[model samples]
Target: MKTFLLFCWLPLTAQAACPTLLNQQLPGLMGGTVDLCQYADRPVLVVNTASHCGYTPQFTKLEALYKRYRDRGFVIVGVPSNDFHQELERNSDIGKFCLANYGVSFPMATKAHVVGPDAIPLYRQLITVSGDAPRWNFHKYLIAPGGTTVTSYGTRTEPDDPKLIGQIEDYLNGMPAPAPSVPPPAPPRLKAISGS
Candidate 1:
């Protein structure tokens, strides 16, 4: 029992060693701390969201994509922002609104600035490497598995757009397909020499 418990707890502890790009924590909209490291080695779609933006409706498709691919190691992270003055005033309000309006079940961060020098550290790093930043709410950054590749998308690209979906499919399919399960060689057939 103790060994089983230890094995179960190992992954949680291992999250502490995630790569730099994902080695941080943020307040989750669901009233908990979301350790970004836990998502390392998984493809993640990070979006800067706002409650009152014209593109707000994208949440539905975003949630849909999340539901469709999450079981396959895909994640969607929503970062509520007021940089464009479209976000709600409080995290609770933003969380409630998203749930009520779009049925969003993915993780979301507390409201923060996602543009300019005041942007969060992660966003700054994203901008530094991607050479593009959120020009408007709902702008997305798709981080490929292993947290190495990042692709930027403008707000005009809806979550369900074929182009975006294709990239996601490509990345996911690119992962070395799981090795087929091979049964252990049938325990060498028991041979009873039986002192013959």
Candidate 2:
């Protein structure tokens, strides 16, 4: 009876262990949408960012990480949020500032509220799966290649942290080669809109 019960619980336990943000389309702050399922074969790091925050300089490191590992099937997505304070003025302006000042080349979504009831749906889902919301600027979520939320790091964790880099390397080594014809879409563009 013990053996049978253990066998019956195995599937449930395994299911719980799997990370799940599959097939969800997160809106871009700029002009397109990214379907998380499309990048299931690559690990993704999502960060909640602020343009005028103290940690804004981390954008440079974040860009470097993306450039180094993007070909190895990894990506970093930035989500600008004004949750803590009115730090980010406008979504389009934030994009321009990042590119001009920090040389940021990764995808950045439009500015959105990441902490309150009006949080974007994708972030709402992210918070549910990861069990935490962005407390401040630069909170990072390292997702596994198979779309599982592997770990969540706070603002203090730099992009090049040894442990984080090791985890990314491990995920890269485990990923199978991507299909030949499925190139990633171009980086999202900033939407045309008035300032906030």
Candidate 3:
């Protein structure tokens, strides 16, 4: 009985360890559930990409970045999106285009709506945390280890941008990644004293 109970609790512990943003299993381009939680504790770069977009060439740079940093616990997950109408109609086609054109080997997700009401849970959480949704294809979000923070980059921000690469390096090195400034805590409200 104790062994059976331990087995049941182990699964719960594993699920709890998944970041809220990546708690679900998203469908992969290759026809299997990509259990995102498995990548927990690793810095992940999530890009909303399209096959036919002009920025499609960015895949080459993304693959380069992935290959350069993957051994250091960094991974890139491409989320093929059609919200901008720039993606191929079929997931298989997108997969082929990425592999053939850029030799992309990073994990790719099925075509997903990455903005507004139809956005997937992962994308929604990304927006909620970063306050930046994909304005167009190739928008990128770099999620630091522990998934407590995310940095947003516009579609035009190339994968090799110094600022982006610097932050990724910092995260992988266990240093704090460059972050947006947060306002200091508001001054304590003073209580009014009434003298009768």
Candidate 3 C-alpha lDDT tens digits along 83-118: 988888999998898899999989999999899999
* TM-scores of all candidate predictions against the true structure: 0.82, 0.77, 0.87
Model 2 RMSD to the real structure?
A: 13.8
Please report the candidate that would top TM-score against the real structure: 3
Candidate with better TM-score, 1 vs 3? 3
Q: Which pairs of residues have clashing backbones in candidate 2?
A: 29-109, 29-110
The alpha-carbon lDDT assigned to residue 51 of candidate 1 equals 95
Runs in model 2 with CA error above 4 Å? Answer: 1-20, 178-196
Give one digit per residue, the lDDT tens place, for model 2 in 25-69. 677766797666667668899899888888988888999999999
Cα deviation at 117, candidate 2, in Å, is 1.9
Backbone N/Cα/C clashes per model: 0, 2, 0
Badly placed stretches (over 4 Å) of model 3 are: 175-196
Which residue pairs overlap in candidate 1's backbone? none
68, model 3: CA deviation in Å?
0.2
Model 2 poorest ten-residue lDDT run: 14-23
